[model samples]
Target chain A: MPKLLEISKPFIVLVEGKDDAEMLYSLTHSMGMPKDEFQVLQYGGKQKFPSFLKQITNFPEFEMVTKLAIFRDADENSQSAFQSIEHHLKSSDLIPQDSVPTHSGEVKKSDSGFAVGIYITPDCSNKGALETLLLDSLTSEMKSEIETYVTQAEKSLSTDRARDKYKNSTKSRTYAYSALFENASFHDTFNKRLWDWSHPTFNQLKTFLQAF
Target chain B: MPLVQSVHFSNYRNFTDFTMDGLQRINLIVGDSNVGKTGLLEGLVTLWGNEEQFKALPNTFRMSYGDYTTSLDSFWSWLHPQRNHSLTMILRSTDIDNLMRAVRYEDHVRYDRDSVERSLQKTPYKINILPIGIGNYEFQVDLFNQLANTKNGKESLVSSLQVIEPRLKGLDYLKLPSSNHAMVYADVDLDYKIPTTQFGHGFTRSMEMLSNLILSGSDIMIADEIENGIHYSALGSVWKAIIDYAVKNDVQVFATTHSRECIAAAHEAMSEQENYELNVIRLQNRKGEVVAINHNKEDIETAFDLGLPLR
Candidate 1:
């Protein structure tokens, strides 16, 4: 249920679910930023993003919002995910008719004078989701160990059984990597034990959020 | 119509320094439990506290928090915890100069020396009616009589009540043979007339709200937990009647609610109206100081769309 009172924040970031919101909240806190400076709204899933945008655009509180950023997972295709959001933005008249930027991760000003940024996660260059991004952020040594473990597991099973069990290389790697952190849920793997702001792996996300 | 454009207060209750701007005709106050949403309303009431209004403060408090004590000492405890500090609130409107200041000791409370003089301006329609929460049955009867006294007032009351209970035909005062005072009765379904209490909680509450809106002649109406006893489905119509009556009578309304349905209903109703202005004020305690965030009509609509939790 929506709250009756809207909490005031200059910037609002829309993510896919509570896990994404919690991760970003942890990251923001680790970077010495106050939680009240920005708000992270979970849209439940990527499919609800367009409806969420329409609602906020129609809302009176969004007028006071200076910046809005949409964060979504690339999943199977980064370009397609980016295009989907771009189409929604253009249709809503949030961006100029001819100014839909070609880059997947660039900030554009809406017609209403609010800054909007779109980011497709697990690195815009890779075809993956937030879990993919988390996997990539692991230390190189841990990454190699997880990959080797997944390979060993794949060889132990028949090719068809392995295919049935693993689904894809990303899922397999995620499972192996998750095992290292006491088999934390995909949502809980981004805790302080596994994430550090000082690590070079977080440079991109840190830079993107700091723009607000 | 006079809108309370802003309100500023210092050392009042849980608020150290608080200022809320861009108040509109209908403002809904919302926040987490115990974040001082009621305190803010009380602060507004205190700002308009005259001798007569001050005398009724205890009843208002009793209605809101169920504290039965009539002494002003209980009211003084609402001041910020810092001892010897004075509570000050300044209300800014287009044409009203309203302020309230009061200091309290362990057992006695007194208005600041200059507060009484500063609050004496005869601003037009400066009446403040604090309904607190539940409307008293006896008070509702008085208001009904006052509304019935004016031409077409009874018809207006019946018309508004029909939105909730279509069977309600009219309202009348009944003088019981056993008692001296009269009680309110609703004429429902053409022939069967029942005491107002038999019409259920919602009917009584709606009657109280409509009668008060008509008879209070108040410039400002403060309703804490305005959604109480009102059905979620009827919220839109109830708000419409409230807004319509408020606008026609030049009354500014401040209401609080923890229910999202109430807020959404108010937003939908306000949007349907041509020129009504509405704001949702969210009170929050950030780092020990109370902060008021004003969400205008558009903002509230967006919040509804995105399922943002305001409480």
Candidate 2:
């Protein structure tokens, strides 16, 4: 179900799901941002952006919203994902009707004078997702071990459909790594510090957030 | 169509230029105190209600008889924003000829009706505003008499009330030998008839609300703080009854609430229907001015589950 965003901070971030929300929550804290400076909202998924954005725009508390940021997966194409977020923002009249921001991490002024920013995961140029970003932050030894375990089990126990579905997915690989520690969720990896946040790989995302 | 399809307010009470469009049949207004939820209802009454309903605004505002005396100029100026005599309070609605407006300037108020309404100034339709902070006992006889006249409506009321209290069997309107006024009696699980006053306010208030809604024959019903008399537990059943009756009778309801339970119960009840018709309008104070934010069925459900601060 599409859930409404609870506005508790002047600056807000709209993420795709619980994993994305949890990822950003701890990631921002790792960057030394105050816990209350930004409110991370799980809008269910990228598919629910329309209804969820409608809820946010119609919420009375949104009057106090001075800044907004959208986090999505680069997933096949980073530019297209940024454009999609821009379309939804314009459709809900959150931004100027015809105005478009030039870059992925650029913070632009909304129609109501609030700052709006968009960031696609795994860097602005990569054709990957948050899982790819997470995997990049892990030690090469741990990454190789998790990958070997998933590959070794896939040939024996995986169905044809599962193989075809996850042929290029980092989600299964990341999940396998999280499972190594008693099968915690991908979001739980953040709290466990399974991913190194200080890595230069997270510089772009951190910059986008700090701009707000 | 609902009586007021959309509304616009300018210099009306706490609102300077607030407009809430896409009005639904069932609207529940939520806001912090002094956000002008009552003022919105009064604006509706000013546009759709009859002369009696207009005159009853002071009482609906919870003002005592002394506070509303004609000698007090402050009472009249208080309707304007900041009590500024220079500013005129204007309320416009889409129902009447695309431009039904009530302008309140100083102590003089005027409502111009288009050709569509032959009796707009003294409309036959009543707003049926059940006020708060006042005893509803004054209308027991009148409401009971109206309810008794319609057998089908009365049966619907009984069945709906049973959802809240299963023991309720029937309702009786009996007049005491000495007094001319009559009172409502509940023939519940007991062998004898007992006055509804003997029951809890939840039962009595629910019974009164449904009875007044069905019997009053008002196209619009404005209830202030609907959850006042009812307990939190019975909120779901009461909402179910209200929504059912409102939809079946084509009556538009505008109610205000301070309880989160009331909001959740309303969402639960409306979501049960195949075609959801619930709209939760929340008013908030942004800086010194107030604004209206309208939420549709799915929007309200999302806010409810997420525990969004709507009120």
Task: Return the clash pairs for model 2, or none.
Answer: none
TM-score of each: 0.56, 0.81
Residue-pair clashes per candidate: 12, 0
lDDT string, candidate 2, B1-311, tens digits: 56667887788777888887777778899988878888888777766666666666666765535333562454555667877768766767666345454534345454553332553553534566765653378676567667778867767778767867788888878886754867777778786777888876566667778887777777788988988867798788778878777777778888998887898889888888766888888887766777677877666655665545566
What does DockQ give for each predicted structure?
A: 0.12, 0.31
Question: Per-residue CA lDDT of candidate 1, range B1-311, in tens?
Answer: 44566777666667777888777889899988888887777666656555455456656644433232545445655554554345443332233333333322223343442443456543433555646555577778778888889988888888877766788788889887765868887787765568887766556766788887666667788888888768787677778778776776678888889888898888877887778588888887655778887776655654665666656
Which has the greatest lDDT?
2
TM-score of chain B of each: 0.75, 0.81
Best by DockQ: 2
